[model samples]
Target: MFPRTLLCLAVFSASTPLLADTVWLKNGDKLSGTITVFDGGKLLIQTKYAGAVAIDWKEVKTLDSDQHLLVKQDAYAGEVSKSLTAADDGKVTLANGEAPKTVELASIQQILKPKPIVTDLVWKGNVDLALDYQRAEKDTDDYDVAFKTSARHGRWRHTGEGEYNREVQDAETTTNNWRAEYSLDRFLTDQWFWQGRINYKRDHIEELARQRVVGTGPGYQFWDDELGAFSLGSLLNRTDYEYRDGSKDNFYSVAMKWDYNRYLIGKKVEFFTNGEVGKPLSGVADYALDAELGLRYKVTDWASLNLKAERDIISGTNDADLNKTRYTAGFGVAW
Candidate 1:
């Protein structure tokens, strides 16, 4: 009876220890505890002291001290060969035994699991709609409605907005404006990237004027993971403006803009400044300088509220001297 009891005790001890086993490899690396999940080229191991350690499956040498494990049993557990080669492009190539596979890194979706040391792709978009009204003591009553959409996929992004405004006072007038922009960002290093963008805008005011502008430029990006990013760029704009009373003007502009953004509470706050100098190409205009300052508060994932003030520092023609200050406040939505 005592021999049978000792046998049962030994069996329980071996099974229990295996359930909480720690794998010690020959390469001086130690992995404590049992592995719970293995997927997406990562091993989710739950340890006793270090909590969870997600080690790259490709970096692992052997498992359980079994030579048979070296055989390629599963797609995720294939044996890889390591090699070092010199390329003609002056770049050193370090090859692992695994065959070069075309990974859809851009389409990867990140999922959070039991253990949390993995990085995943982020893609999102939002849409918003807003209405605005303003009353100035001396000017006309201003009303506006806007729609906007913003989207990001991998390192590419796009934004579009359209707005309709009416001044319901002595000289009633309506205006419509639309803007669309697309940008591509390429990471040159961990903290820096190159950016390129194309933008277009059209504005029409009832019986007063119509204008169209198109621009494209390259820029630089400085990103702070927690504090957002700052960007500086120069754009070349070609504008065609026509007035209601049979007057026409054309101009070319070189503009510089700076953007700053930060997150506060659950909202993103952005500040922007734009300065442009325009040289007349035809008609009765000389040169013009314009400046704008604006602030935006993100209200939702797809909507924001903004306030802006603009001034024309130098007028191009005596007939259309825009030496007055203009203020605008509105809400915008994007999808």
Candidate 2:
């Protein structure tokens, strides 16, 4: 019995260090676990006993955490302050407290902590898949899958996206398209940024087997709030296209890109559009454009329904197969 008791003591000591964070409420209540997000208006936390809980930030009297957090300090005299630090005994002191800036248990913008693999990279990602199937004398099967991810550290952010789509009728392949893009951005200020991008695409129907583009330029973020975000940018691109008929060509061009999104109903519904246009320095087809617009209705934590339309057009020349439009509706998920 004495040996068993000693074993239990050892086990408890080993488990103590991984215990959850703690929150003390104004109503004399305490919550245990990690805080997921603590904006000025609301706080979301995950706990072993309660899975996840949302608390009014005003009701939180104090917090005790070792998690690194990004806090948005209340502005004063037209000056705003921000920091990345850990909490200590319900308060955080920054820069000798000259301003004596005390954090109100609320108003934390984001939380990011370094871990073995994930947080070290500060990454977030989503994967979505859409499928359409029709059964009859002639069966149709079409699928679209996309993966998007982004990571940020300091003033730099990196984003990448990959997509694969295919369609078949009566077991005969009708469409096959794949694309990938990667971009890097450096924030010059709140409203301006510098960016560089690399793009690759392939299409079977258009007789284009491979296309690669590299561009670099500046961008603007006009609006980024609860409503959504709006951004526009332009770049000078070097493009190379390889056709299925063993034909290849390369050129230089100027490209413009715009992306926008809005939340329509609380956090459940969203509308988004992404588009780009490029004008070749010298070509019979002077310009090309690509655009995608979509609406998503979230159904569950990991699932959502979406409707989308996509268009691609080339102007000043007559290549019938080079321009196409498609509409799709299906489901998507994120992590």
Candidate 3:
């Protein structure tokens, strides 16, 4: 009877279900699995619905019962009101309310959504072509083309962009302008990054000949990983330009940019503003300043359109700085 009792006890212990604290080991490798049985240091792991795996006790170093659970959460929490009802003619009428608002669905050219999948490391390229017809104090018509590309790997990022412009007026000689810039950025942390850039510019005016400038700068980035991202940065740049008459001037400037994203015109819109203050190192230009504002809409996964306006508020040392404004509208594509 004593032998029988001992046998029964051993059998019961071997058949008992192991708790979450149990660990399994096999061939010097330790693993955590739902344990089904333990007998004299041998472990039986319940690997899903597929039978049990036997492991030796000597192979396990330790067992961890705690497991991490990852839960996905939505980021957008705001509610959109759909109080307007569409009519048969495609016009929308607002429901009776204290502040009634109505919109025309037919007038909506496109609908855009925020792209959460676009990150800093996606290989992409874009080109923009625009024709600007402007009648300033002086009549000016210009054609512009811009191209940009970006690539990233781990913590390093590279970007390059260039622009070409041609302007014609009835009285003034045709002017040709071109600018190119390249930049590299390195991420130091989730929120902090640093960048270095080089820029070159050339302007040609008939007999007045040509002018050229080159500049370089280093800047910092404050970034957030979320929709409607924002970044603020400042740059210190030095520019040297040569004129048609064999004259040259050197200038220094500090520039800052602010960027934001929002919903506009039934589409996602990106906006940015930039300002710069420049001082001359030599020549006739003592100080110069400029400001620019831009907006873009994503038309598709690989296409977008943008509009920009810029003002040159200051120009030279002797003459009062003349205000020059430029407007551009262009389309961009990415791959």
Candidate 4:
């Protein structure tokens, strides 16, 4: 009888160690699985019954993780990183000590599980093309092309985007403007980051040959969730402008940028808006404004419908405008 009891104890301990994570929902549904991500807005899980499933993070009322997780904190929680195990009633338990501390779940911005080596970095983005032509009358032609991509690995992120627009009427060039920019962000905390950016632009109609801006500064993310996101930052940029008239100017400028995006239809439709104000410390072009407002609709897994209106303004420059606006609509392919 003693030998049989020892065998039963060994079997129970081995099986219990193999048990997966557990998530209890508000509606009394329980899921036994592994948690891939819990971003408060979205939750990803893997289970034997469903293979892989995603659920609204808000619907999860309680969760128990057997593995250690790196947790991001909100401002109210002192912005400290914590290792966590279980969450209950909007409170998460620390895993480090025998006497565990609890943190408010609302103050937890991100909960990261251990990732494998193959998934250390991830990338995604889109490319768009638009063309127009009218050959019968005065031989009118127009074309617009844009591409954007972003990558994330650990606490570092990178983004690159560029666009070109051109129009011709009666064989005369009326509009020619293009800009390319790249940015890098390093996370200092859950809500704050250090950022660096560089940009190059050219506008023929504005009688500008080329303009380049390079800068680095700190940035803050006010809010980021499934519904919407917003961020604002300021940078000191070294700018150089070359005009078609062979005049060249260079200066240091302070630039403020605000960007926001919102989802209207749960990954089907979304809105994006961004604006920038740049003031030169010493140059002919005193200040410049650049902004974009757009919407993107997911048509398929790899294709999306896009509509955008852009505005550019330059004050105290060679050729300034009260407001210059251009509208574009097209389909974009993404991967």
Best model per lDDT: 4
Candidate 1, RMSD to the unseen true structure: 13.0
* Candidate 3 local lDDT, 1-335, one digit each (tens): 99999999999999997644334233444444554332223444656544455555445433433222111111212112223333433343444447534444333221112123422134556687888677888887878887767775446778787778788896565757677777777766544567677767665752223323334444444442212345554566666556666655556655554433433543356565544556655555656655667787878746888898867554663423345677889887645
lDDT of 4 by residue, 1-335 (tens): 99999999999898885768887777888888887665536777788887656677667676777666656564222222234456667676766666677777666656665345523344667798777788986898888899988776557879899999999999899898899999998878767888999999988777667889999899998876545678898899998878878887788999999888887754678798887898888756767999989998988757988898888877787543335888888888976
Per-candidate Cα lDDT values, in order, are 0.48, 0.72, 0.53, 0.76
Candidate 2 vs 3: which has more TM-score: 2
* CA lDDT, candidate 2, residue 306: 85
Runs of candidate 2 exceeding 4 Å displacement = 2-34, 38-110, 117-121, 223-228, 317-321
Candidate number that wins on lDDT, 1 or 2: 2
TM-score for candidate 1: 0.47
lDDT string for model 1 (1-335, tens) is 99999999999898884545334333558686755434445555667777656655555443321111111223212322133232222122224446522222122112122212212222333333334444566345565554434443234445454444455554555445444555555544333445555554444543325555665555555542233346665666676666667686666766565554554543367565554555555544566555656667877645777777756543555345545355777776532
Q: Model 2: per-residue lDDT, tens digit, 1-335?
A: 99999999999999888856677777889998886764335667788876667777667666656555544443111112233233444454322225635554444443434445433245655677889999999999999987777775556779899888899999999899999999998878766889999999988866767789999999997865445578899999998878777777788899899988886765578898888999989773578898989998888756888898989886654233377788888888854
Clashing pairs in 2: 40-107, 97-100
Q: In model 1, state the lDDT of residue 24.
A: 38
Instruction: TM-score each candidate.
Output: 0.47, 0.73, 0.51, 0.71
State the local distance difference test value for candidate 1.
0.48
